[model samples]
Structures are given as structure tokens and as C-alpha cells.
Target: MSPGKTASLQLPSFLHGTYRSVQQKVKREGLRCAEQYRKEGAFPSPRQLLEVPLGEVVVVQGVVDIQHERPVWRLYMVSEVLRDVWEALDWEDSSSVRDAYEASFLETAWGALFFTLARMGAVSAERTARRLEAVLRFWDPLECARYLFKKPGAAQTLEELMVDSCGWAMDAWSPELEGPVRARLESAAKRMERATREDCLEAILRQMPRALAAGHDLKHRQVLADPAFQRERLTMLDTPSFERVSGACTSELLEKLYDWDHELGLQ
Candidate 1:
């Protein structure tokens, strides 16, 4: 296909400009090499044609774009797309293709790093706390357990995933707030671990209020100490909109959070 037509057909706008430029360069170079081989009365293999250093082109273009932009969400979306592309490319046996996939994967990691750093600078501790509470508010231990158990030879239980998720939330906060949050999460994990399989979800749900209460206390203390860290008031979407005591609310919110397919239930 012509370069312009190929670009329009194969590349999304998010990956246009530099990405298209590099792709066109690689395509031209590869075609030139193939034409030379064809004139020599020997057709080159597909692998030989793809032997051009496409990985370097992709990496250079991606790095330049990353440095020029500061949108974390865009970076995240690009990273996810790159990851999918990398996986899709894995079926190819060529070393050059493998190297290009690796380069794409590295770019994905860079995107994630940029996103984390951006969020660290832009998001406030209070906002982080509220987001954490929102996640825990919809924490469904039954679904977690079911998913984990369904996985063959699962290393960590539902409690571990919950605890680890909570720990990740601590990363968005100041060091002072970590102690209380970690303690509460650990305590919750231990409590859930001790529960019977049938009652595990109930045990986890029961801890939600206490976790939120502790989070609020710690958040208040952090805000009092560093008023600058206090976030502006949140909109309805930023915070959970249901009473803590409502199980039905928690179920609905969890369904939304996990993006459960209505036809398949929680997959």
C-alpha cells in the first residue's frame, strides 16, 4: 500500500505524526532493500525484509513524543495500546520483530512511569484518601475470592490482593499518613483471612467502615499539618455516592468499578 493510505488505514490519530513518519521511513528502507535483492535475482525472505532497525525508529519517535507531552491519561492509553501491540507481535518468530516488540514494551513502561510521576505532582493527599475510600467502599471480597480461586495455583489469596491494592494507595499519600493506612489495611487483611470461605466477603465488607474512618482521621491530621496538601472539594464522581451501610449500593458500585459484563456477570 502507498505510505499515506497505509498510515491512514493502520495508524490511529493518537499515533500519527512522528509514529507515522518513523513507520514510513522503515517501510521505505525495507522496500529499498527488498528491491535491491529482487534485482539480484534472489528474493529475500520476509524476515530479511523486516531486518531493518525498526525498533530504534519506534523508540526514538516514542521518546521524543513522551518528552513533548505531559498528559498522564494520554500516556496511559498509549501505553496500553503499545502493550496490546507487543502481545500481538509475539506470534512472529523473527528476531527483528521480537526486538521491536521489546522496544514497544519499554515505551509502555516509560508511559506508566510518566503517568505515576504526573499523578504524584497533580493529585493531592486528600484526593488520594478519598479515592482510596471509594475503592475500599466497593471492595467485594466474594468476587475477589472467586476470581483468585478460579486461577490455577493462585499464589495470593483475596486478602493479599486487597492489602496490596490498599498499599498502592499509600503511594499517592505523604509518608506520615502511611503508618495508619498500612496498619488498618494489614488488620483488615488479617481479619478477612481468618473468616470462613463463605463469610469472607461479609468480613471484608464489615472492615470497609473502619478503614474509611481511619483514612478520614489520618487525612484530617495530614491536612491539618500541611494545609497545602488538602484537596479541593470533590465532585460526585470523585467520591462514592452511597451510604456506607448499604450493601446494595456497594454491590452496584463494585459492578461498575469492575466493569462487569451484564450478560456474563462478574468475569
Candidate 2:
């Protein structure tokens, strides 16, 4: 509803929240900071970034404090930020991505920005598709899983990824995940499914003591280890939400990862 944001294209559910998040951020701070850009002439409306050319829109780095920085947005060129996101956000593999969920909200939001504009038809179809491919190249089950849980904790950004990854942003598009990437995602899902079973076993094993205190051990809970969690590959959930794991439910991704009925692990 901010001025110049009157583009009638209804943002898809997958992207609406992030679009709002960025809008809120602009209203809160960018509005004040953007005045500098206004004087430069030809600056696109900062309030409605979707109005900017896909190649032109730029976002602040997650590590930046816009309040302190004179320039609210990064000095990085649109080309650089776009390339840096995928290149820097890269993990060893799905297992690598699943292990720590290393990509940060500030980082992944770039992907969401592009994804939203694409889904909303804010940009041309060909360009959106091409841009999304690079961003999503870094996405996986763990990537999508980032948003599967409640956004209240440290996962607000992750929830945003879930919108892009699982909320039909990828699935409902004209050209679904195709060619090498689709194969790559399937392979990643397979690995994560097996790994999660192992993850669950360890998590459940660590919960044996609590079950005993309750005078029963019949049902073991899924739990993460202390920061000292020694799995080497993964550790317990940290900070805002320790009780939950990022990719736990993602084990259920595509409903094809695990043989839940017969192979609940524990062997």
C-alpha cells in the first residue's frame, strides 16, 4: 500500500510474506535512508523494489546495520550481489547443507526476493526463470526445510526459504524443477532421508534418560544434543529454538525419502 507500489500483480502466497518483510524494512528505515538515492535522479522507488529491474534491485547484506551505515543498501553491484549469493551460499552437498544449515537469512533473502518477483510476474518470464536457477542451485531439502517450522524462533528467514522451496514457488511454476537440477534434488532428498533416520536415532537415543525419569522408555522423543553434540557432521539446535531441528520434518520430504513403516531406523 505504500506509494508507487500499486502494481496490480497479486504476489503469490509463497512470496507475499517476504515482500511484506522487505516493505516493512523499507518503511522502517530505508524510507529515511533512500532520500539520498532520490537526489541522484532515476532511482527506482525504494518502497516498492519490485518495480526495479530484476538486474537492478539490490539488498542490504545481512551483516549490515542499516541504522549505522550511511548507505542502506550494499555498494556491491547488482551483478555481484546476485552472483555472490549463490557462490558464497554454496555448501558441500545436501548433507553438508543439512549438517549446519549454514546459509543465513540475510543471505537467503536474496533468493526469496528473486523468487517472489518471478512468481508474482513482476519481471519477465524468461529472466525470472534464469535468475531462479542460480539461486535455487544452492537450495536443497535442508534449504526448503529451513522454513518448515514456526517462524517465531531463529527460523524466520528459513521460513521464507520454505516459501520459495516448498510453497509452490518451485513446484507450481510453468517449468517445474527440470533436467539436472531435478535429478540433483532427488539425489539430495535420498541422502537426507537416510541421514535423517540416523539423525533421529541419535536424537532419540539421547532422550533415553528423560524417558526413564518419566518411568517409561517405550516412546523416545526426538531431541538434539548440547552444543557439545559430538556428531561432527551435525550438532543440536542452537539459540532461539533448541527443542527443534531444522531438517527433522524434511525427512518426510516428497514422502519418498524414508521407508517409515518398516525402516524407522534404530537398527
Candidate 3:
């Protein structure tokens, strides 16, 4: 069978339900962790726990024989570090901080699981394509830029929005800091606009290393002394480990999605 047809045939049963199940599992785990935090007097309100964001909910199943122990440990450790930072900020009592931490924890745990599953061949290409589409429906860069810039009616694709955001960042007051950041964002934006969905997935993967490094630095900082913690926290989002998985799975998924779109002849 052709790659596209094979992918189309491999769609998992009830894609929405599978996604929701993962979300619920993450939520339950978050609540359990929050209760532990409350008992330790680190987290004040259980009600502050929020649902995981769509952008962080990648779907995969089964298990890989990867060395997940370290990644899992790192995930919770980052959460602990964030909790400390929140407390240091004197924002421990704030519901917003709690909510953000809850979401972060869920994303970390689930994201690790996802990469492991992907390595194990448990991530179906068709299902992944479907899930990515669903995620992008709400969390696409275009939507984010619109919300950030307060331009909901802006006539721009996600690629354009990304480029514009990069350009806007170039005007930051700190040239030393902003220069590199702006350069990276501009380069990434250009790459991402090349093939739309496929490039977007690659961009997401490319940013993972930077995000992880930022998280590690934040983890080591003296929360009380670091004035950059807040700004860093905004960028240190979402993780994971697995063996060398074939990139073919993701490539096929993207191709299948493109083919499907072409079939529909959508503009």
C-alpha cells in the first residue's frame, strides 16, 4: 500500500476518546500530586489544579524499553523546582500559579510517556496526525499570536504570525539578550513556514532541547535571587526520553495529513 493509504488505514479507534482518556489520567495524577503537596503545606488549594493544555497533549500508547527512570525523575524534579520558585515569588497563595504548576506537571509526565511510546511503535501515525490537527485547532501559533497581540481578526497564517512575533521581539531593550533570541526565532519561523504542519512539528521538536536547557538552568537558580525566574518560567514549558525511534513515523503522518487535506481540496 502507498504510505498515505497505510496511514489512513491505521487510524486508531475513537481517537477523541483515547485523547480524553490520556487527559483524564494526567488530571488524576496531578490531583494526587497536589494532595501530596497540600499535605506538605507546599500547595495551598487543590481547587487550583487546571486541565492540561491541548498543545501539551500528544497521544501515544504502549511502552518502550527506554531508560525512562531518569526522565521521569527529572520531570518531577522540575515540578519541585517550579513549586519552590512560586513560593519564593510569594505567589504560593495565588490560584494562577497553582494552576500553572498543575498544568506543567501534567505536561511533563505525559510528554515523557509520549516520547517513550513513540519510540516503542505505539504511536500510530494516523492517530498522531489526527491528534496534531485537534491540538492545532486551538493551540496553533496563529491563535497564540492573535491572543498575544490582541488581533483576533488579523489576516495571517501561523507562519506569518510567527515571523511577525520574531520581528516584534527584535525591538526588546536588551540588545545582547534579544539579538540571539530574535535571530533564533526568525530562523525558526522561516523554517516552519516551509511545509506548514510538517515543519511545525519539526519546529516543536527543535525547541525541545532549548526548553529543557532553560528548565535545568532555572532549576539551579536561587529562586529568591533570580529576577529572571518569571521570564524564564514563561519559556521553560513542557519533555522526555526514548531510544532512537525512526523519524519515518512522524514523516508519514505529516504526509498523510497533507494528502488528506489535498483530497478535500481545502484552501
**Candidate 1 Cα lDDT to native:** 0.30
- Residue-level lDDT tens digits of model 3 in 195-246: 3434334433433333333343232234312334323332342311111111
Candidate 2 residue-wise lDDT, 102-167, digit = tens: 122113434334343323212222333343443444443213222212222233342354343433
> What C-alpha lDDT do the candidate models reach, one value each?
0.30, 0.31, 0.31
- What lDDT does candidate 2 reach at residue 77? 21
Clashes of 1: 0
Instruction: Name model 3 segments beyond 4 Å from true.
Output: 1-17, 41-92, 99-167, 171-267
RMSD of each: 20.2, 18.8, 21.4
| TM-score of every prediction relative to native | 0.22, 0.24, 0.22
